[model samples]
Target: MPLNSFKSKDNNAKPNRRDSHESTTRRVGVNPTLCRYGGDCRTKGCTFTHVNPPKDGTTKTSDCKYDVNCTRLGCHFNHPNGRLIDQKMVSLPDANQQNTASSRVVSQSPHLEKRAHQRHQQLSESELIEIIDQFLSKVEEFDTNDQESNNSDNEQVLDILEQNALQELRLQKFEFQSAINHLTAEYNSILSSTTDKKYNLLQLRRIKQKLERELKHWESRLPIYARRSDIIEKLEKNQVLILKADTGSGKSTQTVQYICDAHFIDEKQIICTQPRKLAARSLAARVAEEYGCEIGEEVS
Candidate 1:
């Protein structure tokens, strides 16, 4: 039964009735407008209580928005008495429950599992930058080459995610270098062989077609390509060549390759230095890939 309905037979029960009333009554000093429904307020109603009782000796409960149109008649939001918690606030389980649910989902998802594995071996800043640089170079190259083709809309779309991965980046680099090596090998084979030695015309034509297609597919019209001759001439005449070019200008990879092609073809080693160890390692790895040799062999 409700405390208000209780009746004592004893005449001296005024003090007991006052104590019961005081214990049950919610204080009114707290501002209703300032109360944020951050806890179990949605399902369990407002849990906040006033800091002090009102001077008029009446417990004034605010009109809860959740109370109106409440489907469940017995829910705490539907009644004034059920609005405030007696003691400490009731802790909600939503965040912990959501985290547990998400953990389960990640464990079940193969893609997320792969990402978790990658997270353990996150790409170093330098390596990630190198991947991005190479990927952007490829993109720029494609965009430039695409200008000659009339298919503006049908231009090949490059995905950064595929190219920026360490494994995929290395694989793609190796494949590109392999293609270059194959072309060089074909040229060398044709050159070293005697003029009388008969070559298959169909095979030679196929090789030429393949080389052209590869060139058209990957090679971008870049600043390096345009100024390559000028740079080479300057380097040959001058001891130090200082190139002032922006990132993705193709200087990092192209300059070394140009030097190797022009000056260091036979004897002297071309040494490239970077500020950071990671940068040096990344640059070396890229140069090695470009030269179609192992990292320590032609690069280091």
Candidate 2:
């Protein structure tokens, strides 16, 4: 029975009864647009009651968007509902339950499970940057070597999981250093017994081929190469720096070896700047030969 249908004993006073009812009615305030269907609501058929919003923004209810499915105003997800404990996401049930007696039972959706899982995974800023740096560093290091061809002992790609992602950065650094050591050993094996410049050149080519894969990402972080002007110029142009002979004479045997001694910081890097692996390799071999032993043997 509706409240409006209540009957009174006085039959002749209908106009007075309605006026008395109107005087007792009160204006109520609610969430700006808290009108939503009571099907999913905590309360039924009453999103609000004659709600009036405060101007100074001191209102208790939200001024959110309309929740049209609601019995009152409707959905207002993006609304400013500070006091209202609203659901973050509203998903309709997958089952077609509108006409059935058990219309309340919604089908479970795989999409909802996936969304939950996705939200569970989150990476912090430090860990995120470290992962990026590690990847870029690997790209540089591998690009510098011929690991693609002489990969007798390549380390496994670290499993970067959400829980252990920080370990990946440290692990990759270790792996990077290990790879460099392997490459150095590979170079050593080729230079162990070669006296002839041709053999030296041949071995050097192999080394150069390996280094070519390392590419130009050498200083992706360190500024050592970037700060050196002469080295930078050579790296950019793929040119060799040649020191001319003195006075009007033909070049001495010592001129080449002298320069080879000056800039060849690491004997392995004698041709690091050379564009071609073969050229760098041959140069390394010749320098090693002129100095009295195979390259990389510490020719005294």
Candidate 3:
């Protein structure tokens, strides 16, 4: 066979031997000396078995490594102290032995019992009652102190809250006052504007009444006023008309005023033509004077 064949054969044969060893160990039980870590071993592939030692004083297969110095309880290993442990187990006290032990302990300490009895006898019933009363009084005093401290804490909290509330109220009052002042200023401005408007309206009414009186007086004196109704009727009946009158007969001025007062035209303005600018200006000034207005204002 070649070298590779031999190597493969060796590798295959190793698992068979390992498996046989594991089966044999399982049947015959593991040897404790072969496993250094005992039950605490963490090796997954370890060939040694792991188990706790028996604890009923049964026969063991091996001796403990630490011998008499081993501190493990209920260990299933042979040691020099094993016989002593067995003797102690056999010597454990029964119920009757426990009673005898207790009696022996009491008999050995007679001074302890006598001293306790003497102390009890020294304290009178009245003294015991006094001690209990004193304890109760101290407890009451401690409770009162705790209550007083709690009351003081509560009062402090209330005082802080009251101060905060007062501060908030003052802030609100200031805000309200500011709002009221602003409103008052606005009201005063509005009232002043309204009074001015009323005054202007009264002045305009007075001017209008004076202009009406002047217009009535001028109407009677002007020759064109005698034919006012006839002119208005003719103008209303026709979209175009031609009138002939004397130069100073108030033809230009009175005719325009009549048209304006009668509302013969739907538009707010009226256009009049004159042959000369001087005549137009003079008529405008006369009309302005009659209407109680400036030359450049309503008459213009």
Number of the top-ranking candidate, with TM-score as the measure: 1
Ranking by TM-score: 1, 3, 2
**Per-model TM against the reference:** 0.33, 0.19, 0.29
Per-residue alpha-carbon lDDT of candidate 3 for residues 169-252, written as tens digits (9 for 90 to 100): 334334334433443354334435545654534333333333343335332344455566678789779988898974345577
- The window of 10 residues in a row where model 3 has the poorest summed lDDT is 2-11
Per-residue error for 160 in candidate 3, Å, reads 99
Which residue runs does candidate 3 get wrong by more than 4 Å? 1-220, 265-268
Q: Tell me the tens digit of each residue's lDDT in model 1 across 1-300.
A: 443455544455343333444554333323233122211133223434433332343433444332332222122222443323211122323334433322322234445544643442354434433543454456457546544543443324534432233333234344445555666577556546565423433234334434443453234323354565578789778888789964445676567776665545566777777776655666665554344334466432
lDDT of 2 at 187: 58
Model 1 regions more than 4 Å off = 1-192, 195-221
Clashing pairs in 1: 141-220
Stronger candidate by lDDT (2 vs 3) = 3
lDDT of 2 by residue, 33-84 (tens): 3222211233432434322222242323433222222212123223443322
* Residue range with the least summed lDDT across 10 consecutive positions in model 2: 217-226
RMSD of 2: 30.7
Worst 10 residues of 1 by lDDT: 34-43
RMSD of each: 24.4, 30.7, 57.1
